[model samples]
Target: MNKKEKSLLAAVVVGVGVAVFKYFTDRPKKQSIKSLFYLNDFSSISKNFSKEEIEREILKIYKEEINLDDKFKAILFLTMIEGIESLEKYNQMAQETLEEYVKQSSKKFLRINKKKKTGRNIYRENFYDLIEATCEPSSLKADIKLGIEECLNGNFKKGQDIFLSSTNSDKNTFVSLVICYFSDELEKLDKSAHKRHVKNALKDDKFLFLKSYIMDKNNMYKEQIDLLNSIEPQNELQENLRLQHLLINLIKTSDIENKNVNLVNEMIESFLSKKHETTNTVLNIIGISIEWSIINENIDFVKKISDMYLQGDIDTYVDCRLYVFTYLIVNFVEKLSEKNKQNFNFMHLNTDKVEILRKGIENNETYYKLYVYLGGETKDISVYKKALDICITKNEFINIMRILLVTETQNKILQSNK
Candidate 1:
């Protein structure tokens, strides 16, 4: 009886051990979403998936993981999406999501009266009031929205005040404040207050560009260049700052013998030597180079850089393109004598180039006036009249009046010469 029992017990123990080891070894390991995506490798990882595919994958992960909360998932999803989408688009979507989350959670916690209406209706009716009651006065999202609204409404002083007063002061907040301070509406603020705000803004390290810009604005070229050199450019912002430094340096040494020209050549060669993955940086370089060429009185160089910009596959904003185009037209007109203006030909401007210039000027009243002025200066009266008609239709009257006055004076001077 002892031998049989011992043998049976040994067999049972061995079988149980085998079963336990197989069960442990064969079970699926719980993979971390973070480890799978590797947030640090976002650009490389995200390029493999389209926006819709990324959205689906994120949803799948969110549903599959019970421990991972919605807020955390949302944050991770946002980080991944940002690598794929433009920064402006990412910021807009993320801010909207945050606003909705804040609104919904605030409604639940603040005990806003639901009345007899359904949840959706109740939220719709009391949304703004609920936000006002529940949002922290210091909330970053709230402050950003408020500041943006104020700026859009042409109340730059109010916007600047809101941005400066933001309790959650960070890089974004400081950036917003700097933008407001630089806006055309800053004229509405007291001169002393505006100066004070600019001084206060220059104190932040993240605002090196703003500080440099202010220095440049005040004609402190050496200081601006020094500040720009002090910055270690890691991204597009810092890179652009470096470019600005180069351009400002060129401007400062314009009167010197060959100094600005040599600097321009160096800048052009430096940019061309690098393999730029981003078109924006390259386009920026080309645009500034064109300006540098004009400053150096190298009309041929201007034409060459303009051709490069027009022919490149760079997808830049309308404003950026318009800035380059405006400079090109201005320089071209300035170089042409009145007798030569009559011989000037618009035939060289191809449809694609015209379309690009038109797209850049569309909806931009200030730019439209500049285009009109350029046309008038070049004796393209037909183009000027057409642009004027469009401006009249769009009710862009203020700049229209200024453009008309300038054009009329120019016409009178030409008539007097005749």
Candidate 2:
């Protein structure tokens, strides 16, 4: 071969080597970014990941120059991470990012609409409405803020008047109106006017649950039942509505032989049978059923169902485990009450059962009621102290104190009478 040809041949070989090296070196980075995209895509269904793991993955991805669409997606995924270890600092950051993105996007949308104004843009209308209707405090007016505080303080009449007087009758105003009506503030207002407001607001599915609640209150049982039945629950809030509907029906049918009991039983079985049912769903069903049984004064049924839940045949989801334990404690107290016993013997429970109750008691808010029941039944002041220590909310602590006082007074009266 000629020397020039040899030099060209070596150059070709070197170029091929560099290309191969680049492909191999960059492949993993590309794959890592691709994997992050997949994680973001399937985040809604990705239940196996811990919150810390998700946070780490999100932080790693955030360092990259992700496209706008994927950035929004990552923000959404971050929102779904449960029990965020940083007390939701990450969630707050995500929310700020989302708000800024929405602001920029809104400006862009307006520019587009102005340039192409053939007619009103429906997308712009809906998107802007959504941004305005979000529960962010920054999106609300001062009057709306005052109205919310008034409603919370039980000044529903004042709150409702303020909410209705606002020129901005967005979704939150409608919600406040419903709250006022439910609180009976509208009794002084014109019934026709209240009905009109509700009718107009009923277009949003967000109000459907409240509408059903109104129907249930007004003895429009069939209408409420139909409304609840029409709803296909896609998330935990909707599932709660479904459970509430069932509970209302159970309450309406006062007959001891009501067929709704069988329906509830079937629902419980169906939910337990489903491997995909969320912990929140399972807990809702169980809690509702327990409340139903209590309403019916069916203590025996409570015992039966509580025992079934505590037997561990069904895998107890972590969030629901405390609830199950609370139910077990309630059942124990009720059984003791039935036998006219003042205190329960811990020796009766197996070691594992005792451990379960102890672990449950360690979870303050989740097992708050259990502490109340235990304190009342055993006349244990220490139990009340434990409950009060973990109680953060003023209303809950006040309620617990009232319970303790009443129980103590009852005990004194009983001892004196004896």
Candidate 3:
């Protein structure tokens, strides 16, 4: 009741209020499920930490985040991470998460809007950066894994069937199917069927990235850039794809000394470059850039890049393997032909490297063409016939012509000997 007591009570009240406010304001915010959307975050972490450390952090997050949305995101994250062979040890956990995901996702809680939106599209909105449109697709991770396994085992028809069967149900599956069709591992896909699937895949707006990849394959650099520019990238993969194709377009269209090439290189290096080992993914981009450099006859740039990143164990990378083959074949062919030998430096053919590359590659039809070419050079009638058979089977009209030329020359030599 005294003035002193009243003042003390007032001070105590203010102190309690201040303490409560500080507690609420300084407390951590609940982690958002959207954090899993940008895989670049995990990629950056993986670069710095061991896989066990990353898995511990991820598992801690999964355990702490009990909210359904965050839980589903964690499951999908596990699936995505498990897809990388580095985290193959997480296989058991991935299956458990996947089963739980299927159980929960089968409920009618998630609403899917099939009608196209004006920007970014629904898959980005609902799945947070994942390219899948529905929960059903995520559940098909096992099938996708099997298809990839089949492809790796060189069962092209079985792999193609596994992928094609799931295409009607999921955009992710359809994209995988398209990628396998073009990939060297599974080269036996019927051309018409692949084209049809590509046509259908393009009907979906999210497939613009896939379309750009196809455009790049066809040498439509300008068109590919224009198409990529139309939409914003939803995730790290799309963003990387955009940057890569843009760099490729610059290389294909611009002179080697163009400043725009440097600009794109800086942008790409910001994301892709490492002080030590570069990733297989980065090697693929670099490999394609080298290929375009070869096409442009910028041998200086090619040599510089080859020396820089082409060190270490590159044999496992398909694009880099092809780059080596292309470099060797072009060098040999140019020197052998009088008309084309002017611009190219007379680089000695390293037959040892060629044999090593050939052994490293699997049963790829594209690289097999090199064998056909070598067989043609032998000029034996039996070799020529075998080469012709391959050229016809694979629809290599240029190789077919070369084989016929060898046949004609052999015939003339035989008649003269007789």
Candidate 4:
């Protein structure tokens, strides 16, 4: 085993040792240590571990938890363990009750939930209890969906059994999706026969991205960046489809902003210097991050954007930068005051496509603003105090202002009391 694996194993031994001591020595002991170990009492198992070793033991417990002998229970355990391991990054809400112990669940994938605390995907008490309970076919359907999502994300082995065990009627699309993701081509069992599968075949972006991922796993960086910039004027086919490769690219490039792209200054200028810039949509959403800002002289850069076409021919514009600049300004700036933040104004900036931009910004701003409001920064109200939630399903993030809203309401209550 590698050094890291060795370290993890060492930790598991120490952790389990302590937990056994605690179970035997602590007062009010309910169950026997042997019984817990046999039954995969991982929560107790976890207390014995430290660091990543906790995750290692969880994986061990997980293997014992699943089996074809008890197909139904196995699928539930697999899905539940997946959520615990991943903290549901690939699949949000996979384990609703696994909050506290998730600190060390999936050592790799990270997810931010409504609580905004970065943690693991532990099943806590829920998954174990569920699997031990009598679950129906429909309940199995939910478990399979979760498993299928994970499988789509490259966890094929566990996902496949979940597919095989779940009732065929409920999991047809998911089964088809899982099948397609693994590139499993069974004999001509009427590929076109499964409507849900066909539908997933038609609309799912994750499935499409998976195919692209497997075929060209290497050198995918540049290709995916090119794809994210290509999101536009796509029919229903594109709408449901995600440029996940691009999304990953964004995540990687995202933190670079705080570090400063000094060497790439010329590239930065060149990006905005395109003739048919396609709304300067060429820029990654990461470029106009919620963190940084430009100077006032550059504030009028929105005005210089006038030399191009905003929406190209769609909206009659001599310069596209006018609309694109305005969109970025509205997003990056926390709040805009008609009086103070006056030099650069974008609301209703376009006579023709103004409404379209307005609505798009509004919807996105609802969630995005919350991000800036919470741990993010924006001096202006444009960046209000809002809490953001991660959308693991869409592989995107959203802000939840409701978190701070309660705080505001509480403030009002205090003021009224005063």
C-alpha RMSD values across all candidates: 27.9, 24.8, 27.9, 21.4
Ranked by TM-score, the better of candidates 3 and 4 is 3
Runs of candidate 4 with Cα error greater than 4 angstroms are: 1-260, 276-358, 361-418
Q: For residues 121-177, what per-residue lDDT tens digits would candidate 1 score against the true structure?
A: 211212122123223325537665687556543345666677657764433435433
- Per-model TM-score on C-alpha atoms: 0.47, 0.43, 0.39, 0.28
The order by descending lDDT is: 2, 1, 3, 4
Q: List where candidate 2 sits over 4 angstroms from the true fold.
A: 1-165, 168-173, 176-178, 181-206, 217-220, 233-240, 251-257, 276-278, 290-317, 320-361, 366-368, 381-406
Candidate 3 has what TM-score?
A: 0.39
**Per-residue lDDT for 3-30 in model 2, tens only?**
9999999999999999999998878543
What lDDT score is found at residue 175 in candidate 1?
A: 45
- How accurate locally, in lDDT, is each candidate? 0.50, 0.52, 0.49, 0.38
Indicate which candidate wins on TM-score. Answer: 1
Per-residue lDDT of 1-418 in model 4, one digit per residue for the tens?
9999999999999999999999889867555433444454534533444435544543454446433222222222334332355644413322321321122222222332324233222212112221222223255457765764554343445555666567763345435544543433222234454434544543434333443333233334555555445546233223222322344354446455533343233333443465433322222222342122343234433433433323233244322223344445544343545553555443444433344343333334323422433222222222233222332321122122322332333333233324
True lDDT of residue 186, candidate 1: 46
Q: On lDDT, who's better, 1 or 2?
A: 2
Output the lDDT of residue 196, model 1: 59
The better candidate by lDDT, 1 or 3, is 1
Q: List model 3 lDDT by residue over 87-191, tens digit each.
A: 554556545554554345333221112232222111112222223311234454688657644543334457666776774533563554355333433444566
